[model samples]
Target: MILTREAITTAVEHGDIVIEPFAPERVSPNAYDWHLGDRIRVCEGDELDAAAATRVSEHVIPAEGMVLRPGRLYLGVTHERTHSERYAQMINGDRSLGALGIWVHVSAPLGHVGHAIRWTLEIRAAQPVKVYPLMPFGKIVFLSTAGATASYQHLGHKYTRTSGIDISRLYEELR
Candidate 1:
Protein backbone atom coordinates (compact mmCIF):
# COMPACT_ATOMS: atom_id res chain seq x y z
CA MET A 1 0.00 0.00 0.00
CA ILE A 2 1.01 3.61 -0.42
CA LEU A 3 2.48 5.25 2.62
CA THR A 4 0.92 8.17 4.49
CA ARG A 5 2.69 11.33 5.54
CA GLU A 6 3.04 10.08 9.10
CA ALA A 7 4.31 6.75 7.88
CA ILE A 8 6.87 8.47 5.71
CA THR A 9 8.05 10.49 8.66
CA THR A 10 8.32 7.35 10.73
CA ALA A 11 10.24 5.58 7.99
CA VAL A 12 12.71 8.41 7.84
CA GLU A 13 13.00 8.45 11.58
CA HIS A 14 13.64 4.71 11.62
CA GLY A 15 16.29 4.96 8.90
CA ASP A 16 14.31 3.02 6.34
CA ILE A 17 14.05 6.06 4.12
CA VAL A 18 16.41 8.92 3.42
CA ILE A 19 15.96 12.28 1.74
CA GLU A 20 19.00 14.46 1.60
CA PRO A 21 18.28 18.11 2.24
CA PHE A 22 14.87 17.06 3.40
CA ALA A 23 12.49 19.89 4.02
CA PRO A 24 9.49 19.39 6.27
CA GLU A 25 7.47 21.87 4.27
CA ARG A 26 7.90 19.86 1.08
CA VAL A 27 6.09 16.81 2.34
CA SER A 28 2.50 16.49 1.25
CA PRO A 29 -0.22 14.22 2.58
CA ASN A 30 1.16 11.24 0.69
CA ALA A 31 4.21 12.40 -1.28
CA TYR A 32 7.13 14.78 -1.08
CA ASP A 33 7.83 17.49 -3.61
CA TRP A 34 11.22 17.47 -5.34
CA HIS A 35 12.87 20.41 -7.01
CA LEU A 36 14.62 20.62 -10.35
CA GLY A 37 18.40 20.69 -10.35
CA ASP A 38 20.45 23.37 -12.04
CA ARG A 39 21.70 21.30 -14.97
CA ILE A 40 19.80 19.93 -17.95
CA ARG A 41 21.05 17.69 -20.77
CA VAL A 42 19.46 17.54 -24.17
CA CYS A 43 20.34 14.93 -26.75
CA GLU A 44 22.28 16.48 -29.59
CA GLY A 45 21.29 14.18 -32.37
CA ASP A 46 18.05 13.66 -34.20
CA GLU A 47 18.35 9.90 -34.00
CA LEU A 48 18.76 8.30 -30.60
CA ASP A 49 20.27 4.87 -30.03
CA ALA A 50 19.22 3.26 -26.79
CA ALA A 51 22.63 1.64 -26.34
CA ALA A 52 25.02 4.43 -27.39
CA ALA A 53 23.43 7.84 -27.30
CA THR A 54 26.07 9.91 -25.56
CA ARG A 55 25.75 12.95 -27.77
CA VAL A 56 24.07 15.42 -25.46
CA SER A 57 24.38 19.10 -24.72
CA GLU A 58 24.20 20.25 -21.11
CA HIS A 59 22.77 23.57 -19.98
CA VAL A 60 22.31 25.29 -16.67
CA ILE A 61 19.11 27.09 -15.87
CA PRO A 62 19.84 30.74 -15.20
CA ALA A 63 18.15 33.10 -12.78
CA GLU A 64 15.73 34.15 -15.49
CA GLY A 65 14.87 30.51 -16.23
CA MET A 66 15.15 28.38 -19.37
CA VAL A 67 12.64 27.73 -22.10
CA LEU A 68 11.65 24.14 -22.81
CA ARG A 69 10.42 23.51 -26.31
CA PRO A 70 8.21 20.76 -27.56
CA GLY A 71 9.44 17.72 -29.53
CA ARG A 72 12.62 17.46 -27.52
CA LEU A 73 13.69 15.45 -24.54
CA TYR A 74 15.49 17.21 -21.73
CA LEU A 75 17.16 15.19 -19.03
CA GLY A 76 16.96 16.86 -15.62
CA VAL A 77 18.01 15.83 -12.17
CA THR A 78 16.29 16.30 -8.83
CA HIS A 79 17.93 18.58 -6.31
CA GLU A 80 17.51 15.97 -3.57
CA ARG A 81 19.09 12.55 -3.38
CA THR A 82 16.62 10.02 -2.03
CA HIS A 83 16.88 6.40 -0.99
CA SER A 84 14.73 3.76 0.67
CA GLU A 85 16.13 0.54 2.03
CA ARG A 86 12.77 -1.09 2.68
CA TYR A 87 10.29 0.60 0.42
CA ALA A 88 9.98 1.10 -3.32
CA GLN A 89 9.88 4.62 -4.69
CA MET A 90 8.01 6.22 -7.52
CA ILE A 91 8.50 9.69 -8.92
CA ASN A 92 5.68 11.47 -10.66
CA GLY A 93 5.21 14.85 -12.16
CA ASP A 94 3.71 17.39 -9.83
CA ARG A 95 0.11 18.29 -10.59
CA SER A 96 0.91 21.93 -11.12
CA LEU A 97 3.71 21.07 -13.50
CA GLY A 98 1.53 18.57 -15.32
CA ALA A 99 -1.14 21.21 -15.79
CA LEU A 100 1.53 23.39 -17.32
CA GLY A 101 2.27 20.56 -19.81
CA ILE A 102 5.50 19.52 -18.20
CA TRP A 103 6.18 15.82 -17.82
CA VAL A 104 9.00 15.23 -15.40
CA HIS A 105 9.31 11.51 -15.99
CA VAL A 106 8.42 9.19 -18.79
CA SER A 107 8.18 5.44 -18.14
CA ALA A 108 11.13 5.03 -15.77
CA PRO A 109 9.65 6.48 -12.60
CA LEU A 110 9.77 3.29 -10.53
CA GLY A 111 12.70 2.53 -8.24
CA HIS A 112 13.72 -0.59 -6.41
CA VAL A 113 13.70 -1.06 -2.65
CA GLY A 114 17.43 -0.46 -2.36
CA HIS A 115 17.53 2.36 -4.88
CA ALA A 116 19.72 5.19 -3.68
CA ILE A 117 20.13 8.03 -6.10
CA ARG A 118 18.91 11.39 -7.19
CA TRP A 119 16.28 11.00 -9.88
CA THR A 120 17.10 11.75 -13.50
CA LEU A 121 14.00 13.28 -15.01
CA GLU A 122 12.83 12.60 -18.53
CA ILE A 123 11.61 16.12 -19.01
CA ARG A 124 9.40 17.16 -21.89
CA ALA A 125 7.10 20.04 -22.60
CA ALA A 126 3.86 20.14 -24.48
CA GLN A 127 4.60 23.70 -25.49
CA PRO A 128 7.06 26.45 -24.83
CA VAL A 129 7.39 26.91 -21.08
CA LYS A 130 9.94 28.61 -18.90
CA VAL A 131 11.30 26.59 -16.01
CA TYR A 132 13.59 27.66 -13.25
CA PRO A 133 16.12 25.79 -11.22
CA LEU A 134 15.07 24.63 -7.76
CA MET A 135 11.46 24.62 -8.92
CA PRO A 136 9.24 22.03 -7.33
CA PHE A 137 8.49 19.90 -10.37
CA GLY A 138 8.09 16.34 -9.16
CA LYS A 139 6.56 14.36 -6.32
CA ILE A 140 7.85 11.07 -4.95
CA VAL A 141 5.73 8.42 -3.28
CA PHE A 142 6.99 5.43 -1.34
CA LEU A 143 5.38 2.01 -1.46
CA SER A 144 5.68 -1.01 0.79
CA THR A 145 6.80 -4.32 -0.63
CA ALA A 146 5.17 -7.64 0.22
CA GLY A 147 8.37 -9.43 1.21
CA ALA A 148 12.08 -8.86 1.45
CA THR A 149 13.73 -7.71 -1.77
CA ALA A 150 17.28 -7.51 -3.01
CA SER A 151 19.09 -4.21 -2.79
CA TYR A 152 19.83 -2.35 -6.00
CA GLN A 153 23.39 -1.85 -4.87
CA HIS A 154 24.13 -5.57 -4.67
CA LEU A 155 22.25 -6.12 -7.92
CA GLY A 156 24.76 -4.04 -9.88
CA HIS A 157 22.28 -1.71 -11.45
CA LYS A 158 23.84 0.71 -13.93
CA TYR A 159 21.87 3.67 -12.64
CA THR A 160 22.44 2.91 -9.00
CA ARG A 161 24.76 5.72 -7.96
CA THR A 162 24.02 8.46 -10.44
CA SER A 163 24.80 12.04 -9.34
CA GLY A 164 23.34 13.95 -12.27
CA ILE A 165 21.47 13.54 -15.52
CA ASP A 166 22.45 10.00 -16.60
CA ILE A 167 22.75 9.35 -20.28
CA SER A 168 21.23 6.05 -21.31
CA ARG A 169 23.43 3.13 -20.24
CA LEU A 170 21.43 0.57 -22.17
CA TYR A 171 24.20 0.02 -24.70
CA GLU A 172 26.84 -0.66 -22.11
CA GLU A 173 24.58 -3.02 -20.23
CA LEU A 174 23.76 -4.89 -23.41
CA ARG A 175 27.39 -5.43 -24.32
Candidate 2:
Protein backbone atom coordinates (compact mmCIF):
# COMPACT_ATOMS: atom_id res chain seq x y z
CA MET A 1 0.00 0.00 0.00
CA ILE A 2 1.08 3.56 -0.63
CA LEU A 3 1.80 5.77 2.31
CA THR A 4 -0.43 8.73 3.11
CA ARG A 5 0.97 12.18 3.85
CA GLU A 6 0.60 11.64 7.57
CA ALA A 7 2.29 8.28 7.39
CA ILE A 8 5.09 9.81 5.33
CA THR A 9 5.56 12.45 7.98
CA THR A 10 5.58 9.82 10.69
CA ALA A 11 8.13 7.78 8.77
CA VAL A 12 10.36 10.81 8.44
CA GLU A 13 10.13 11.44 12.16
CA HIS A 14 10.97 7.81 12.87
CA GLY A 15 14.08 7.90 10.62
CA ASP A 16 12.56 5.46 8.18
CA ILE A 17 12.38 8.22 5.56
CA VAL A 18 14.79 11.06 4.92
CA ILE A 19 14.34 14.07 2.68
CA GLU A 20 17.16 16.53 2.87
CA PRO A 21 16.21 20.17 3.18
CA PHE A 22 12.72 19.03 3.89
CA ALA A 23 9.94 21.56 3.81
CA PRO A 24 6.60 20.76 5.37
CA GLU A 25 4.67 22.89 2.90
CA ARG A 26 5.83 20.81 -0.05
CA VAL A 27 4.00 17.82 1.32
CA SER A 28 1.02 16.91 -0.84
CA PRO A 29 -1.88 14.58 -0.07
CA ASN A 30 0.10 11.43 -0.95
CA ALA A 31 3.50 12.67 -2.06
CA TYR A 32 6.11 15.32 -1.52
CA ASP A 33 6.78 17.85 -4.24
CA TRP A 34 10.43 17.92 -5.34
CA HIS A 35 12.22 20.63 -7.23
CA LEU A 36 14.63 20.70 -10.17
CA GLY A 37 18.26 21.00 -9.27
CA ASP A 38 20.59 23.54 -10.83
CA ARG A 39 22.45 21.14 -13.08
CA ILE A 40 21.51 19.08 -16.15
CA ARG A 41 23.28 16.77 -18.55
CA VAL A 42 22.80 15.92 -22.20
CA CYS A 43 24.42 13.02 -23.96
CA GLU A 44 26.51 13.83 -27.00
CA GLY A 45 26.16 12.35 -30.50
CA ASP A 46 23.20 11.48 -32.68
CA GLU A 47 23.13 7.72 -32.34
CA LEU A 48 23.60 5.81 -29.11
CA ASP A 49 25.05 2.33 -28.66
CA ALA A 50 23.72 0.13 -25.92
CA ALA A 51 27.04 -1.58 -25.31
CA ALA A 52 29.26 1.49 -25.26
CA ALA A 53 29.49 4.29 -22.73
CA THR A 54 28.12 7.52 -24.14
CA ARG A 55 29.63 10.94 -23.66
CA VAL A 56 27.54 13.57 -21.89
CA SER A 57 27.81 17.32 -21.47
CA GLU A 58 26.77 19.06 -18.28
CA HIS A 59 25.36 22.54 -17.78
CA VAL A 60 24.08 24.59 -14.92
CA ILE A 61 20.55 25.88 -15.12
CA PRO A 62 20.72 29.61 -14.50
CA ALA A 63 18.35 31.23 -12.07
CA GLU A 64 16.55 32.84 -15.00
CA GLY A 65 15.71 29.33 -16.32
CA MET A 66 16.59 27.10 -19.26
CA VAL A 67 14.69 26.01 -22.34
CA LEU A 68 14.29 22.33 -23.15
CA ARG A 69 13.65 21.46 -26.76
CA PRO A 70 12.16 18.42 -28.34
CA GLY A 71 14.29 15.65 -29.90
CA ARG A 72 16.87 15.84 -27.11
CA LEU A 73 17.20 13.89 -23.90
CA TYR A 74 18.17 15.99 -20.91
CA LEU A 75 19.27 14.46 -17.68
CA GLY A 76 18.34 16.35 -14.54
CA VAL A 77 18.46 15.78 -10.82
CA THR A 78 16.06 16.56 -8.01
CA HIS A 79 16.94 19.36 -5.64
CA GLU A 80 16.12 17.03 -2.78
CA ARG A 81 18.20 14.02 -1.72
CA THR A 82 16.00 11.38 -0.17
CA HIS A 83 15.94 7.79 1.01
CA SER A 84 13.59 5.41 2.74
CA GLU A 85 14.64 2.29 4.57
CA ARG A 86 11.10 1.24 5.30
CA TYR A 87 9.36 1.98 2.00
CA ALA A 88 9.94 1.98 -1.74
CA GLN A 89 9.66 5.22 -3.72
CA MET A 90 8.39 6.36 -7.11
CA ILE A 91 8.47 9.76 -8.76
CA ASN A 92 5.98 11.24 -11.20
CA GLY A 93 5.97 14.41 -13.20
CA ASP A 94 3.69 17.17 -12.03
CA ARG A 95 0.49 17.72 -13.97
CA SER A 96 1.40 21.34 -14.61
CA LEU A 97 4.58 20.29 -16.35
CA GLY A 98 2.79 17.54 -18.23
CA ALA A 99 0.30 20.05 -19.60
CA LEU A 100 3.29 21.95 -20.96
CA GLY A 101 4.61 18.76 -22.68
CA ILE A 102 7.38 18.11 -20.19
CA TRP A 103 8.19 14.59 -19.06
CA VAL A 104 10.42 14.35 -16.00
CA HIS A 105 11.14 10.67 -16.44
CA VAL A 106 10.81 8.31 -19.35
CA SER A 107 10.61 4.80 -17.90
CA ALA A 108 12.67 4.45 -14.71
CA PRO A 109 10.95 6.28 -11.89
CA LEU A 110 11.02 3.50 -9.35
CA GLY A 111 13.65 3.87 -6.63
CA HIS A 112 14.99 1.00 -4.61
CA VAL A 113 15.34 0.90 -0.85
CA GLY A 114 18.48 2.46 0.75
CA HIS A 115 19.49 4.26 -2.45
CA ALA A 116 20.07 7.68 -0.96
CA ILE A 117 20.64 10.44 -3.46
CA ARG A 118 19.19 13.22 -5.53
CA TRP A 119 17.22 11.36 -8.20
CA THR A 120 18.41 11.48 -11.78
CA LEU A 121 15.56 12.48 -14.05
CA GLU A 122 15.08 11.44 -17.65
CA ILE A 123 13.68 14.65 -19.10
CA ARG A 124 12.08 15.27 -22.45
CA ALA A 125 9.60 17.68 -23.93
CA ALA A 126 7.09 17.45 -26.73
CA GLN A 127 7.69 21.13 -27.43
CA PRO A 128 10.09 23.78 -26.20
CA VAL A 129 9.51 24.50 -22.50
CA LYS A 130 11.22 26.84 -20.09
CA VAL A 131 12.19 25.35 -16.75
CA TYR A 132 13.88 27.10 -13.89
CA PRO A 133 16.25 25.98 -11.23
CA LEU A 134 14.52 25.01 -8.00
CA MET A 135 11.13 24.89 -9.68
CA PRO A 136 8.70 22.31 -8.39
CA PHE A 137 8.60 19.71 -11.16
CA GLY A 138 7.71 16.33 -9.69
CA LYS A 139 6.24 14.50 -6.73
CA ILE A 140 7.69 11.46 -4.95
CA VAL A 141 5.39 8.87 -3.49
CA PHE A 142 6.41 6.29 -0.90
CA LEU A 143 4.99 2.79 -0.62
CA SER A 144 5.01 0.15 2.08
CA THR A 145 6.84 -3.13 1.34
CA ALA A 146 6.01 -6.65 2.46
CA GLY A 147 8.08 -9.68 3.42
CA ALA A 148 11.87 -9.53 3.64
CA THR A 149 13.73 -6.46 2.45
CA ALA A 150 17.37 -5.91 1.56
CA SER A 151 19.15 -2.59 1.19
CA TYR A 152 20.30 -1.50 -2.26
CA GLN A 153 23.85 -1.32 -0.98
CA HIS A 154 23.82 -5.04 -0.35
CA LEU A 155 22.51 -5.54 -3.86
CA GLY A 156 25.47 -3.65 -5.41
CA HIS A 157 23.44 -1.13 -7.31
CA LYS A 158 25.09 1.08 -9.92
CA TYR A 159 23.78 4.50 -8.97
CA THR A 160 24.85 4.63 -5.36
CA ARG A 161 24.88 7.89 -3.41
CA THR A 162 24.85 9.99 -6.52
CA SER A 163 25.35 13.71 -5.86
CA GLY A 164 23.96 14.96 -9.17
CA ILE A 165 22.65 13.76 -12.50
CA ASP A 166 24.02 10.31 -13.32
CA ILE A 167 24.00 9.20 -16.90
CA SER A 168 23.26 5.63 -17.95
CA ARG A 169 25.51 2.93 -16.58
CA LEU A 170 23.70 0.31 -18.59
CA TYR A 171 26.79 -0.02 -20.77
CA GLU A 172 28.64 -1.32 -17.75
CA GLU A 173 26.30 -4.25 -17.53
CA LEU A 174 26.55 -4.90 -21.29
CA ARG A 175 30.31 -5.22 -21.13
Candidate 3:
Protein backbone atom coordinates (compact mmCIF):
# COMPACT_ATOMS: atom_id res chain seq x y z
CA MET A 1 0.00 0.00 0.00
CA ILE A 2 1.14 3.55 -0.72
CA LEU A 3 2.00 5.55 2.36
CA THR A 4 0.20 8.75 3.25
CA ARG A 5 1.84 11.96 4.46
CA GLU A 6 1.02 11.08 8.05
CA ALA A 7 2.39 7.59 7.61
CA ILE A 8 5.57 9.02 6.08
CA THR A 9 6.05 11.35 9.01
CA THR A 10 5.41 8.52 11.45
CA ALA A 11 7.77 6.25 9.54
CA VAL A 12 10.50 8.86 9.72
CA GLU A 13 9.87 9.36 13.41
CA HIS A 14 9.98 5.58 13.97
CA GLY A 15 13.08 5.14 11.76
CA ASP A 16 11.30 3.12 9.12
CA ILE A 17 12.05 5.91 6.63
CA VAL A 18 14.85 8.46 6.47
CA ILE A 19 15.32 11.70 4.57
CA GLU A 20 18.25 13.96 5.13
CA PRO A 21 17.34 17.63 5.62
CA PHE A 22 13.72 16.66 5.90
CA ALA A 23 11.12 19.40 5.65
CA PRO A 24 7.60 18.88 6.81
CA GLU A 25 6.31 21.40 4.27
CA ARG A 26 7.72 19.35 1.42
CA VAL A 27 5.52 16.42 2.23
CA SER A 28 2.46 16.09 0.03
CA PRO A 29 -0.57 13.93 0.55
CA ASN A 30 1.29 10.77 -0.47
CA ALA A 31 4.72 11.85 -1.67
CA TYR A 32 7.67 13.99 -0.69
CA ASP A 33 9.06 16.66 -2.99
CA TRP A 34 12.77 16.33 -3.62
CA HIS A 35 15.21 18.89 -4.96
CA LEU A 36 17.78 18.76 -7.75
CA GLY A 37 21.40 18.38 -6.79
CA ASP A 38 24.09 20.71 -8.10
CA ARG A 39 25.77 18.11 -10.27
CA ILE A 40 24.73 16.50 -13.56
CA ARG A 41 26.34 14.33 -16.22
CA VAL A 42 25.79 14.19 -19.94
CA CYS A 43 26.69 11.30 -22.20
CA GLU A 44 29.88 12.10 -24.09
CA GLY A 45 29.55 9.97 -27.17
CA ASP A 46 27.00 9.94 -29.94
CA GLU A 47 27.07 6.20 -30.19
CA LEU A 48 26.59 4.32 -26.92
CA ASP A 49 27.17 0.59 -26.53
CA ALA A 50 25.22 -1.41 -24.00
CA ALA A 51 28.06 -3.91 -23.47
CA ALA A 52 30.59 -1.14 -22.83
CA ALA A 53 30.73 1.29 -19.95
CA THR A 54 29.02 4.50 -21.01
CA ARG A 55 31.16 7.60 -21.00
CA VAL A 56 29.72 10.70 -19.32
CA SER A 57 30.95 14.23 -18.67
CA GLU A 58 29.97 15.71 -15.34
CA HIS A 59 28.96 19.36 -14.95
CA VAL A 60 27.92 21.38 -11.95
CA ILE A 61 24.75 23.32 -12.54
CA PRO A 62 25.57 26.98 -12.22
CA ALA A 63 23.95 29.39 -9.76
CA GLU A 64 21.77 30.83 -12.51
CA GLY A 65 20.76 27.44 -13.95
CA MET A 66 21.57 25.06 -16.81
CA VAL A 67 19.66 24.57 -19.99
CA LEU A 68 18.80 21.01 -20.97
CA ARG A 69 18.36 20.54 -24.68
CA PRO A 70 16.25 18.10 -26.56
CA GLY A 71 17.64 14.80 -27.90
CA ARG A 72 20.19 14.58 -25.11
CA LEU A 73 20.24 12.36 -22.08
CA TYR A 74 21.40 14.12 -18.91
CA LEU A 75 21.87 12.36 -15.64
CA GLY A 76 21.02 14.41 -12.55
CA VAL A 77 21.02 13.76 -8.80
CA THR A 78 18.56 14.55 -6.06
CA HIS A 79 19.72 16.85 -3.26
CA GLU A 80 18.19 14.68 -0.55
CA ARG A 81 19.66 11.37 0.50
CA THR A 82 16.97 8.96 1.55
CA HIS A 83 16.56 5.40 2.74
CA SER A 84 13.87 3.02 3.89
CA GLU A 85 14.50 -0.60 4.73
CA ARG A 86 10.82 -1.23 5.33
CA TYR A 87 9.35 0.42 2.26
CA ALA A 88 9.95 0.70 -1.48
CA GLN A 89 10.30 4.08 -3.26
CA MET A 90 9.33 5.44 -6.63
CA ILE A 91 10.01 8.86 -8.14
CA ASN A 92 8.15 10.93 -10.68
CA GLY A 93 8.44 14.41 -12.14
CA ASP A 94 5.93 16.92 -10.81
CA ARG A 95 3.17 18.04 -13.15
CA SER A 96 4.46 21.61 -13.11
CA LEU A 97 7.78 20.40 -14.45
CA GLY A 98 6.15 17.89 -16.75
CA ALA A 99 4.15 20.61 -18.42
CA LEU A 100 7.44 22.33 -19.16
CA GLY A 101 8.66 19.16 -20.95
CA ILE A 102 10.99 18.00 -18.24
CA TRP A 103 11.08 14.29 -17.59
CA VAL A 104 12.85 13.40 -14.35
CA HIS A 105 13.41 9.82 -15.40
CA VAL A 106 13.41 7.86 -18.63
CA SER A 107 12.60 4.38 -17.34
CA ALA A 108 14.06 3.46 -13.95
CA PRO A 109 11.97 4.80 -11.05
CA LEU A 110 11.69 1.93 -8.59
CA GLY A 111 13.97 2.00 -5.57
CA HIS A 112 14.90 -1.29 -3.95
CA VAL A 113 14.91 -2.00 -0.25
CA GLY A 114 18.12 -1.02 1.55
CA HIS A 115 19.36 0.92 -1.49
CA ALA A 116 20.20 4.03 0.44
CA ILE A 117 21.51 7.00 -1.50
CA ARG A 118 20.68 10.16 -3.42
CA TRP A 119 18.65 9.16 -6.45
CA THR A 120 20.12 9.53 -9.91
CA LEU A 121 17.66 11.24 -12.19
CA GLU A 122 17.51 10.17 -15.85
CA ILE A 123 16.60 13.54 -17.30
CA ARG A 124 15.45 14.50 -20.78
CA ALA A 125 13.79 17.66 -21.92
CA ALA A 126 11.25 17.58 -24.70
CA GLN A 127 12.49 21.06 -25.51
CA PRO A 128 15.11 23.39 -24.16
CA VAL A 129 14.41 23.78 -20.47
CA LYS A 130 16.43 25.55 -17.82
CA VAL A 131 16.86 23.94 -14.40
CA TYR A 132 18.44 25.31 -11.28
CA PRO A 133 20.39 23.62 -8.54
CA LEU A 134 18.40 22.81 -5.41
CA MET A 135 15.22 23.54 -7.32
CA PRO A 136 12.16 21.49 -6.51
CA PHE A 137 12.44 18.73 -9.12
CA GLY A 138 10.35 15.70 -8.38
CA LYS A 139 8.32 13.73 -5.86
CA ILE A 140 9.04 10.36 -4.33
CA VAL A 141 6.34 8.10 -2.99
CA PHE A 142 6.90 5.18 -0.65
CA LEU A 143 5.06 1.88 -0.64
CA SER A 144 4.73 -0.84 1.96
CA THR A 145 5.78 -4.35 1.02
CA ALA A 146 4.23 -7.66 1.99
CA GLY A 147 6.11 -10.87 2.69
CA ALA A 148 9.89 -11.32 2.80
CA THR A 149 12.34 -9.10 0.95
CA ALA A 150 16.03 -9.22 0.09
CA SER A 151 18.33 -6.25 0.47
CA TYR A 152 19.61 -4.65 -2.74
CA GLN A 153 22.99 -4.12 -1.11
CA HIS A 154 23.43 -7.85 -0.62
CA LEU A 155 22.58 -8.42 -4.28
CA GLY A 156 25.83 -6.74 -5.36
CA HIS A 157 24.14 -4.13 -7.51
CA LYS A 158 26.40 -1.80 -9.45
CA TYR A 159 24.44 1.32 -8.54
CA THR A 160 24.53 0.80 -4.79
CA ARG A 161 25.34 3.68 -2.44
CA THR A 162 25.80 6.29 -5.13
CA SER A 163 26.69 9.85 -4.05
CA GLY A 164 26.31 11.57 -7.42
CA ILE A 165 25.03 11.06 -10.93
CA ASP A 166 25.83 7.50 -12.01
CA ILE A 167 26.06 6.51 -15.64
CA SER A 168 24.60 3.28 -16.94
CA ARG A 169 26.31 0.29 -15.34
CA LEU A 170 24.54 -2.22 -17.56
CA TYR A 171 27.94 -3.12 -19.01
CA GLU A 172 28.82 -4.84 -15.75
CA GLU A 173 25.93 -7.22 -16.13
CA LEU A 174 26.90 -7.94 -19.73
CA ARG A 175 30.42 -8.95 -18.75
**By TM-score: ranked, best first:** 2, 3, 1
Per-model TM-score, in order, reads 0.96, 0.97, 0.97
Stretches off by above 4 angstroms in model 3 are none
Candidate 3 displacement at residue 66 in angstroms: 0.7
Ten consecutive residues with minimal summed lDDT in candidate 1? 45-54
C-alpha local distance difference test of each model? 0.89, 0.89, 0.91
Please give the distance, in angstroms, between residue 28's alpha carbon in candidate 3 and its true position after superposition: 0.4
lDDT of 2: 0.89
Model 2 Cα shift for residue 57 (angstroms): 1.1
lDDT of 1: 0.89
Question: Which regions in candidate 1 have their CA more than 4 angstroms from the true location?
Answer: none
Q: What lDDT score is found at residue 53 in candidate 1?
A: 55
Alpha-carbon RMSD, each predicted model: 1.1, 0.9, 1.0
Query: Can you write out model 1's per-residue Cα lDDT over 1-175, one digit (the tens) per residue?
Result: 8898999888988889999989878888999888999999987777888767578899999979999999998999999999988999999997799899998787898989899988898989999999999988888999999976899978988888888899888899777
lDDT per residue, candidate 3, 1-175, as tens digits?
Answer: 9999999999999999999979999999999999999999998778889999878989999999999999998999999998988899998889989999998885999998887989999998999999999999989999999899988877888888688788888888899
- Worst 10-residue lDDT window for candidate 3 reads 152-161
Clashing pairs in 3: none
